[model samples]
Target: MTLKVGTILEGTVVNITNFGAFVDVEGKTGLVHISEVADTYVKDIRQHLKEKDKVKVKIIAIDEQGKISLSIRQAMPKSSRPVEIDWQGERNKNSGLSFEERLAKFLKESEERIQDLKHREGRRYGTASRR
Candidate 1:
């Protein structure tokens, strides 16, 4: 069967590498890049996947040269995906504020975040370097 973008299919893990895994889908091989393996950080590809393992992957892209790019993360159900913070939405929710008020509030929040980051860096290293 021909592979098409956005199609979810079952494939066998033909090979595993430090960067990614190769999956066999209906006689075609596709690379599931390490970042596409899971929604969270994947320090080692083998920690999450292995050879000969059957996995459900979504065909995310296909190049003109017939290279297939798959995503095991996208194949997962939406309910299981990570919750992304909607920063823009949160800002827009306070749209009733005056432009000046909004700007002042944003500046205050930015300064607070910068200080917090610096504090964290100071704990990690000797002293926090000003950005």
Candidate 2:
């Protein structure tokens, strides 16, 4: 079968590697990179899949060498996904704190953390060497 981008297909996991999983798709083997295995971070690919596992994957790219890139996450329906938090949006929602107030607070906290780190380094190594 001719593979095309965005086409969803059923494939059997033929091999597993540290970087990704190889799937046999209708006689054509494609790679589903670990990062493409899920919508979130995957520390270990084995945790999410196993050899011979039947999985649904979406065709993401096809290179000149016929190396097919697939994504299992894209094939999954969006409704089942976890809510992704936007840190910037959350900070903006704090309407009570002005930009200047936030900046000042950040600077003060950063200074305190830096001092603490320096103290820890000095204790651990008899003093941190100056660059």
Candidate number with greatest lDDT: 1
lDDT of 2 by residue, 6-28 (tens): 99999999999999999999999
| TM-score of every prediction relative to native | 0.68, 0.63
- Local distance difference test scores for all models: 0.95, 0.93
Number of backbone collisions per candidate: 0, 0
TM-score of 1: 0.68
Q: How accurate is candidate 2 locally (lDDT)?
A: 0.93
lDDT of 1 by residue, 1-131 (tens): 76889999999999999999999999999999999999899999999998999999999999999999999999999989978788999878888999999999999999999999989989799786778
The deviation in Å at residue 30 for candidate 2 is 0.6
> Pairs clashing in candidate 1?
none
Residue runs of model 2 more than 4 Å from their true location after superposition: 83-131
Clashing pairs in 2: none
